[model samples]
Target: MTIILAWYRDLIELTMSSNLMTMVQPGAFSNLIQIGVLNLRLNNLTTIKSDSNSITNIQSGAILNLPKMRELNLQSNQITDIRPGTFSNLPNLPRLRLSSNHITNIWPGAFSSLPQLRWLDMCSNQLTYIQADAFSNLPQLSYLNLASNQIATIPPDTFLDLPQLMKLVLLNNPWQCDCRMVAFSLSSAEMLTNTIK
Candidate 1:
């Protein structure tokens, strides 16, 4: 469905949760220049791009023209894949919630555009593996939650890009107790120690 918010030029927050929306046409929020918070939780959104059929594959310019966007909530959806440049349009977004979705894979550069993001929640998803650069380019990201997923192991440098990351939650996952896990544990401890200093 097309969401024409042209009349609400000065709108700051818009919540379209539980709307059962399957698709959102491009330029849906083009006129909401002052918008900061957008909540699209509990929807049937398979793809953020009108031309795509995959879940959560947000192509560039799909939801563009929101220069002031800060918080975006897409929880409890059928999102499975987080393609690269998904949030390229929301440059100023800080907090993103993708919990309780069907997310299985996070491609490289998926969050490359969100330079100012601080908080990210991906709990209760189907994430099994994450690329090393999936969370790259987010220099300001500090908090990350990956609880209740099917992840078994992660790349050693999976979080190497997040220099400011302070909190990382990975509870309820099938983590393997191998050398990789040992390395990750040591690195994480070091990062936390630095953050505390």
Candidate 2:
């Protein structure tokens, strides 16, 4: 269902948390052009993509038409997958919170839309494996939280493209500590130590 917010032209922040929203049609917020912060946490959203085939003619994602958005909160939802172009509209977005979801897979280039994104929180999810290029194309990312997931091992070059990354939280995962994890662990240890210092 489309939420018509065309009258509130000067609206900046919109909070619709804990509303039991199942799905948001594409261009749901197309009228909220000046909006910066959108909080849709604690919903029952399974997938951000709408069921309409017309979405292909527009944008293929949950959030659309909000160009000025900086912070998006979609935590505590039932989201399972993050497909490519899911966030293709929010170029200026800086922070995204997807924690406490049922996310198991993140398609490649899922986050390539947010060029200015700096902070990403994906803690407390069901993520088991992450592709090496999953986190690529994020030049301004600094803080990433992947704690409390089911991930055991990730590729050594998983964080290679994130030059500005200063903090990475990977705690609470059942790590294997095998040869494949040696390089990543050593580098992560150094990064964590430097962050502490």
Best by TM-score, which number?
1
RMSD of each: 2.4, 4.0
Span of ten consecutive residues with least summed lDDT in model 2: 50-59
Give per-residue CA lDDT, model 1, range 1-197, as digits (tens): 44457898999998888877766667777778999998888887787763222235555667776779989888887888888767778888999999988999998988888899999999999999878888989899999999999999987778877889888899999988888788777876776677789
lDDT of residue 40 for candidate 2: 78
Which pairs, if any, clash in model 1? none
Deviation (Å) of 114 in candidate 2: 0.9
CA shift of 145, model 2, Å? 0.1
lDDT of 1: 0.82
lDDT of 2 at 51: 21
Instruction: Note the Cα lDDT for every prediction shown.
Output: 0.82, 0.80
